[model samples]
Target: MSKPVLIAGPTASGKSALALALAQKTGGVVINTDSMQVYRDLHIITARPTPDEEAVVPHRLYGHVDAAVNFSAGAWVTDAAKVLADARAQGRLPIFAGGSGLYFKALTRGLSAVPPIAAEVREDVRARLERDGVEALHAELAVRDPASADRLKPRDRTRIARALEVVEATGRSLTDWHREGLPPLLPPGEFAALFIAPERDALYARIDARFDAMLAGGALDEVASLASRNLDPLLPAMKAHGVPALIRHLKGEITREAAAETGRADTRHYAKRQFTWFRHQLPEFEWVMPGDARGWVASVIPGREANPESRDSGSGPSDHPGMTWS
Candidate 1:
């Protein structure tokens, strides 16, 4: 079986384009590792591949879950395991592509096996957080589970609530459960991973241009439709990069120009965060500039040329002597 190719990069870094090109060349199936792209309701806003793009190659796990469900990393792992198995059985290369660092980490490094938090307990903790604020929750956690509280910041509402819920429901600290984690789906040296590291200015320009294109392509309409559903504000889909600002625009709280600006800023910030996260969290992934990415992949995967005309054109990795691979 061919070693799976995992392409990770920030938003607007051409991850999808590279995945599609590789998939076309290697008879591979592209798998979604992005957290937002899983929601069926978010197409334009999430920058999910259009139907035409999907038709180019076999794609799995995109827009498969309802936005109402609180899809977790664990759930994504479970779904991805099945898809990976199928790809291996069919003798097709699995190309995992996306910007979600946590999802990638969960796949490569095992995730903590924290049991499900009861709905009532979860709701109660969230309600308390809403009423008493995150500081109060942190104080409570400090009294109940000092170790977790020490590890978590006071302003971290999500982690604070989760730690509190775990302690309340199971009488065990979150750290205790975290000590035992599920085994990694793809262990070290079993797969080839690459992180695209484009020049920051160029990437930021691309992100801004992409957001404008998305707005022109009816991102506002998509957000309006999703907002009409009145799902919980805390839901991941509701807080997607552009969704919140667009929803504010829909509510007349912000002008369209302001909303667009906010969306672009948020996306740029997210892309920056993705770069830092992948660098620090998954250091094993080799970083390559945009122009060199295709050539790098071609080198790692035997019999796969970076471009069909490269040999004739004499413009391959051999020509660019500065290409870095570690």
Candidate 2:
């Protein structure tokens, strides 16, 4: 069987395009590794593959969950394991693609086995954090779960609240559950992975242009519908890169122009963070610039030509011999 392909990159870095091209050539199925794209309500805002793209190649796990659901990395890993097995059984390559570093990491490495916390528990912790402030919560965590407190910053409201919730709900520190993690779905030496790295300035330009295009493509209406639902503001979908800003505009807190600018800035900052996270957390993935990714992927897959015409032109495989796929 061919090795499964994993394509990870920052937003607007052409990850989906690369996945689609390779899948078309290899008879593969594209599986989503993006956190935002999983929401059914976020098709346009998340830049999900359109129906036309999905019709070209088999796609799995895209827009499968509701925006109100608190989908976690562990949940995605479980879903992905089933999809990976089905694809392998059918003799099709599984092309995992997206920019969510944590989701990708969970697939390639084991994830913490923290059990689900009740909605009430999560809401209570969030409420306490808001009422008593993060520092107060940090102090409480320091007393209850000092191990977590010592590792978390006082200003880290999310982590602080999470630690408190786990301790409160399960009577164990978050670090304890982390020590007992689920095995990796795709362990080392089992998959071929690549991270797309584009020129910083060019990437920023694409991000800006894409945000403008999203605004034109009814992203505002999408956010407006989501805002009307009165879902929890802390849900991941609610805080998607542009959602909060667009919601602010809908609430008359900001002008449309200002919302668009804020969304653009937020996406650029997120792209920068993705670059850093993947570099530091997933060092094993081979990094290729946008122009070279297609050649790099083709080179790693057996019986595939990087460029068919080059075979007769007296040119050899693209000079990316440093990367090896097992």
Candidate 3:
């Protein structure tokens, strides 16, 4: 694998900007890892880079999905592998960038061997949950797979239901399949990845401000355009962070102001969750301030060495706080 610079951070953290800078410097391809940005009609709302910015540097996997399909991290990693392979074959660096933590994790650590649930099984589980309530499903899951149930909150219907549904359809617990040992996708030795850890209060302010800007920039109209297409509301694309609230506003179910406020709040909450996930699950990534893109990137990639202490023989980070400077 060719060395790829991963520019990751919370929402509104200038990850895309940093990625473009690195791409321009290194003749790389900027691959989108954000789950929302994959939705085709969500360019402005997902803040997909402008054409001029894209023209300055090649980008892959942004605004390419129809809202009807639920795009998964597993699917994203598969797509990203092709982009990375292409970039390497062309002797160009691959710039992996986005706020979606799962996509990045899948790219680095690989996903579990969980099969896609059959449509009927999925619909049946969803209907059962809706009819029987979260607690009922929670108890059932506890009886079936106590490990996953213990880890999940009883009210975290999104995941708890998924765990139960997987067990029901596959006749194997999701946790059991997870332990079945899937092979690495990229493996740790392949590339350099970074996680941008911004100060919390500042990140919140940026989140609120960006949501306002997104609204001013026709996020409502974008959602309206998507809604006009009549894509299933339950689809992952339609349920993107700001899409639901904006769609509600468009449907006259909520005032525009209320919708925007809820969207901003949701983004802020998601940013918090993203940080927690990265810090806890993937501590191997070098943490960097977004402002030092050029120097930090130069320090880690290829021949240049920034911090002698963190670098290894192959491309991997040390058990420390900065880039590997081989």
lDDT of 2 by residue, 1-326 (tens): 67889999889888888887777666778999999999999998888888777876778999999999988998999899999999988878899999999998999898999999999999999898888999999999999999999999889877888899999999999889999989998899999999999889988998898888888999999999999999887788998989999999999999999999999999999999999999999999999998788778987796853333212222112212222222
TM-score of each: 0.91, 0.91, 0.85
Off by over 4 Å in 2: 304-326
Better of 1 and 3 by lDDT: 1
User: Could you report the Cα RMSD, in angstroms, for every candidate shown?
Assistant: 5.1, 5.6, 7.0
The candidate, 1 or 3, that scores higher on TM-score is 1
Output the lDDT of residue 286, model 1.
96
lDDT of 3 by residue, 1-326 (tens): 34677788888777877776656555667899899999888888888887777776678998877777767787787788788778888777788889888777777777798888887887787788888999999999999989999999999877887898789889999888888655555787777888777778977888888788878888888888998988645567777788888888888899989998888988888888988888988787877775454567777775632222212212321211232222
| Candidate 3 TM-score over all chains jointly | 0.85
lDDT of 1 at 263: 95
Q: How does model 2 score by TM-score?
A: 0.91
Q: Of the pair 2 and 3, which is ahead by TM-score?
A: 2
lDDT of each: 0.86, 0.86, 0.77
